[model samples]
Target: MSSRSPAPPNAAPNARAVLAANLIRLRAEKGWSQEALAFECGLHRTFVAHVERQARNISLDNLERLALALGVQTYSLLMP
Candidate 1:
């Protein structure tokens, strides 16, 4: 194994909410529209909008892409 402890209970259930809030906040901070962020991350604009709406879950790769485009660590999207 790994040295890190497991995530606390409720972490998994809240990840989508965390990601949605952060994405919206970060996008606004960058003064970017959903389309702009999607273009930067190579995702569809509706996909970005859906993510911000917490309407769907995405793969780790997409999460990383969004974080990179937002100039943040991958974990940042999953954290509160």
Candidate 2:
């Protein structure tokens, strides 16, 4: 028998969550604090924290800035 159980309503992974998880992982891999990354990206430290926590809906321009600061492609930030 299949072990998989159906997901409840609204249980699907959202883009913000995926982005948050990826951002957290990448930031940790680079040994950067949210403040440090924000400084590098020329953004407010609180903004970075909000993004990492999936509390803000980031824009495409901001995404590009983050990718450039991190030396990664913008699309890389969106991948699962």
Candidate 3:
């Protein structure tokens, strides 16, 4: 029998969750607080928190800023 579990209706897709999850991971990997990332990205710290929580949709420009601050390509944030 298969042990696979059914997907949740509200769960983020693998691709999207990976993107959001990576944002959090990369920040931690760099030993940065959300406030630090916000400062480096020229954004408000609450905005960083909103992004990490997937509560806010970011524009490409903001994504680029975050990528630059994280020392990664913008696409890296979308990795699965």
Candidate 4:
């Protein structure tokens, strides 16, 4: 038998969760710290953390800021 554990059950889809996961993935792929991304986005580090944690309902303007900083379209963040 394989040593790897079975995949966990899939959770229900959520917009905020999708955005948060995409943010983490993109940031890691770019080797950027949350602080670095915040600087690039012209937002506070704590605010970026909150968004990553899905602790806040991110605003459209901020979404645009993040997309611009990440060099992606805003809809990319919203996509599943």
Going through the candidates in order, what is the number of backbone clashes in each? Answer: 0, 0, 0, 0
**Looking at model 3, which ten-residue stretch has the lowest summed lDDT?**
11-20
CA lDDT, every model vs. true structure = 0.89, 0.87, 0.84, 0.91
> Across residues 1-80, which tens digit of lDDT does each residue of candidate 1 receive?
54546678865656767889999999999999999999999999999999888787799999999999999999978877
For model 4, the stretches where C-alpha displacement exceeds 4 angstroms are 1-12
Q: Name the best candidate (by lDDT).
A: 4
RMSD of each: 7.6, 7.0, 6.8, 7.5
Q: How big is the positional error of residue 67 in model 3, measured in Å on the Cα after superposition?
A: 0.4
Deviating ranges (above 4 Å) for candidate 3:
1-16
Q: Which 10 consecutive residues of model 4 have the lowest summed lDDT?
A: 1-10
Candidate closer to the true structure by TM-score (higher is better), 2 or 3: 2
Compare candidates 1 and 3 on lDDT and give the better one.
1
Answer with 1 or 4, whichever has the higher TM-score: 4
TM-score of each: 0.82, 0.83, 0.79, 0.84
Model 4, C-alpha of 49: deviation from truth (Å): 0.5
lDDT of 3 by residue, 1-80 (tens): 43546569996565445767988999999999999999999999998888887667788999899999999999989876
In terms of lDDT, which candidate is stronger, 2 or 4? Answer: 4
Candidates in descending lDDT order:
4, 1, 2, 3
For candidate 2, write residues 1-80 as lDDT tens digits. 43545557878666777788888888899999999899999999999999987778899999999989888999989887
Q: Candidate 2, 13: how far from true, in Å?
A: 2.0
Residue 26's lDDT in candidate 3? 94
